[model samples]
Target: AQSVSQHNHHVILSEAASLELGCNYSYGGTVNLFWYVQYPGQHLQLLLKYFSGDPLVKGIKGFEAEFIKSKFSFNLRKPSVQWSDTAEYFCAVTAVSASKIIFGSGTRLSIRP
Candidate 1:
């Protein structure tokens, strides 16, 4: 079965800090990767995606992720983050199954002011 797993269920940080979350998938085929972020008080929004071109993709609000086929993972990373970046992050993957995407549970990010 195709599945995605997130490393942390919740993360806490100060107003200004760096953030890195792990995301792993169980599949060995052509895939489309995505990272969706839901702000503290907002709906879900796309952070980034890896379709076919570059393995390194950058997204809104200074967020990015790298797709490592060997590791079967696509990890999200941010050098510096702000309180506004506090949100619930979910990693999703779409394979050739022609079915819906497989999304990891999620990682809740909390930024303390």
Candidate 2:
């Protein structure tokens, strides 16, 4: 079974500040990592994902995640954030052969102007 953990429950940052949300998964075999974001009243949107071919995957809205297999980590990063970027971010993981996805608790990002 695969599980995800998001170390930060809530993150408050000003506009243009760099952002990095820690995400770790417990899975030994081949797996896939994903980052999803949900705006205040919007549905969950796929931010980025990592399966193979590349350890570093770039996502929508200037977001990126690096899949460090050695550390079982897939942390999401944004060089600069904006007020509109405020949302709840979730880290998910699923085995290559599995259909069900396990999701983290979620980290709320509050961007202050």
Candidate 3:
């Protein structure tokens, strides 16, 4: 069975601290991975995604993710933290042939200013 897994349920960070959110999948075949974020009062938006070509993809707000095929992991990274970056992050995966998308349990990030 293919599924997405998120290691952190809640995370707290101070301003200027580095952040890393772990995400892994169990699919044996090829898959498209994505990181989506929802701000406190805003709609969910894409942070980054990995489909093909580059293993590393950069997204808005200094966010980046590296896809490691061997580990079935696509971890999100941010060098610095801000209060505005506080949000819930979800990792998603979908197979190229499958229409359904599986989402991991979201991680809530809180930043102290």
Best by lDDT: 2
Candidate 1: list runs displaced more than 4 Å.
none
Clashing pairs in 2: none
Give the alpha carbon lDDT tens digit for every residue of 1-113 in model 3. Answer: 89899999999999999999999999888899899999999998999888898999999999999999999999999999889999999999999878998999999999999
Poorest lDDT segment (10 consecutive residues) of candidate 2: 1-10
- The per-residue C-alpha lDDT of model 3 at residue 8 equals 97
TM-score: model 2 vs. ground truth: 0.98
> Tens-digit lDDT track for model 1 on 17-47?
8888999999878899999998877898999
- Candidate 3 structure, TM-score to reference: 0.96
TM-score of each: 0.94, 0.98, 0.96
Kindly list the per-residue Cα lDDT of model 2 for residues 1-113, writing each as its tens digit.
67899999999999999999999999889998999999999999999999899899999999999999889999999999999999999999999989899999999999999
